[model samples]
Target: MSTGMPAYDESGDRSRRPTATNRTAAQVNTTALLDRLRTAGPQSLSALVQHTGLSTATVNRLVDRLIDEGLVLEAGRAAPTGGRPARLVGFNARARSVLALDIGSSKIAGAVTDLEARVVRRRRSAIVPGDDARPALYFFEALADLAASLVKDAATGPAPVRAVAVSVPGVVRRDTGRVEFAPSLQWYDLPLGALLEERLGLPVRVANDVNLLALAELRHGAARGRRDVLTIALGTGVGASLVLGGGLYAGSGGAAGEIGYTLLGRESLSTPWPGFGDLESRVGTAGMLARMRERTDALPDGFGPEDFLGLARSGDEAATAVLAEVVDDLSLTIGNAATLLNPELVVLGGGFGRAAADLLVPAVRRRLQGRIPLLPAITGAELEEAQLIGAAELAIDLAAAAPSPPT
Candidate 1:
């Protein structure tokens, strides 16, 4: 269970200290320095001192220790000044690795990335339904197998991994690491974090898939550095993730963005929809398909939400009409979310979001223009794997922020 970091120095050592106050400043300084390094990359000792507002001696000592621990490295010299150019120190991204898992209703996608969020390995697996009696275990086994395979293939030189971040398609409480409910997956109160951590022998972090996507966007995509933002992932289920004050906003029960359960129109027996009273139940891919089927018996094979969008793009009249209705419905939903959250920007993401980007963005924008006096700017996610990409981010952020245990 030794994580390979120097936990303590019991024997006589020049740097070892027995008093808490002796190490308090170093700990605080390191945390502050790490944040700067993350944001601005490598810097000279003078630059670090100025950025962290720490003394030059303290910055130099911290940078030296980080370099010795392989957490940082001396890159080239800074620009030629009058004297010798100070050695530039930068974060050694390869020193730490993280595994990100994107668990979905019908498939699982995963990728291993370095501390800098560079993907080292990627894998995907189809998630066929379990015997209905043990769905949780079935999905878990698939995830474990994928993690094991990735770890085996990776170069294990680094001290294992700092953590694993799993993105689930529902409300995820960060404190408990429990997935409250993933209606698309029909999961509830599942200890997904503990299960993965125990199975893989590493720390595990979990978050709502849409929320994670928003985190990814904020970190490295369209929503970078934005304070108030909303990301709506349109997939098997419609969900929203909000970021306020530069941090993701999860409600009291971690159910802040369960937009799928919204009420939209009345239900009829002739059109029996899954989760029949819910709005997402009415407009989700399946619902749209069911309605589409009523109009045309010759529905295209494998006609899901993505296909519907493709058909719309191809100028299929039926498909266009269906997508138009979806756009209108989604526009209304977006307006409601915008009015309430008043986010700086609203990003449309996930499988449906990407495919219907051509359709959804314009419709949502137009809806906002007419409905609200003030509208948040609308945009589509740039990444193909927005959810999985965000999963990587969640893992790295948690690992960097975890507290060290006392000796």
Candidate 2:
């Protein structure tokens, strides 16, 4: 099961006789140094020492370890500051590869990416309605097959996949890496991460799709510079993810972003889906399409949410009316979230959200402007494949933190 390449240990050797508290401190400092270099670009040893507030010797030792692990690289020399020019080091973003998956309602998308989370190869497969009814063995087999194909097709030619990260439309238990609930996919308490790790022979991480979207925005998309941010995804369904004080907040049960279940009106005995809740039935893509169908029987054969938005933008009266109603419902829900969280930035993402952002943002803002005590900036996501990108980010992080192989 060895990867042929030497494993990396971001926290240095844990078997050393350093005190537990000192080891923890060193690990934290190492993470901070890597993050600093990754974000601020290359820096000289002295510069890193100054930024990290660590002693020169400590910084030098850490840098040497990182370089030996292939996570850090010497970029060049810095300008002399009255003495010898210091050599600069930077994150080696392409030194390793990660495999990421985005399991959606009707499709599963996989990609191979570098340490920078840039996709190098991608593949996808459709999921039929009855697929989930099959045994978990079959499901895992199919997933593992797809993952193997993706790895084999990596453009780098047989490079080891350092880690795997999967995104599911569900509440993922952070501690157990279990899908606690996934109404859309009918998954409950599934140990998906463990199964994947067993099959792939590598560390695996799982997260909620919406949460990953928020992470993508917070790290590399529109909400990059914001500390408190909210990402609302409107696709086949509706969900929200929160980032508070520059960190993703998954709440106690990993359900912090389950805003789609918020009640907007009286509860119904018959649900849209088996476990779908009130607000989702009203504001989700399915609801929007149903409403559009009710308004017009002459609808195009394959009309979808995107097509409806296009028609609305082109001044179709019926489409515009349908969009306005959905916008109202969404604005009300988002306004409630805004009032409670008071996020610095609200990023609208997902297929429907991104397509209808130009139309929805203005209306949502108008609805919130008068209701909330303080208004926050609202905008659309500026990144594509946000969930995939975020999954890659998680994979890179897990790979970077993994223990080094014995020499």
Scored by TM-score, the top model is: 2
RMSD of every candidate to native, in Å, equals 7.0, 5.1
User: Which lDDT values do the candidates have, in the order given?
Assistant: 0.72, 0.77
What does candidate 2's lDDT look like per residue over 306-329, in tens digits? 788778889998988988888788
Best by lDDT: 2
- For candidate 1, write residues 217-313 as lDDT tens digits: 8777888767788888776677888787666677787778777766655553345545533656546777788878977789758777767766778
List the candidates' TM-scores in order.
0.84, 0.89
Backbone clashes for every candidate come to: 0, 0
* C-alpha lDDT (0 to 100) for residue 154 of candidate 2: 69
* TM-score for candidate 1, residues paired by index: 0.84
* Count: clashes, candidate 2: 0
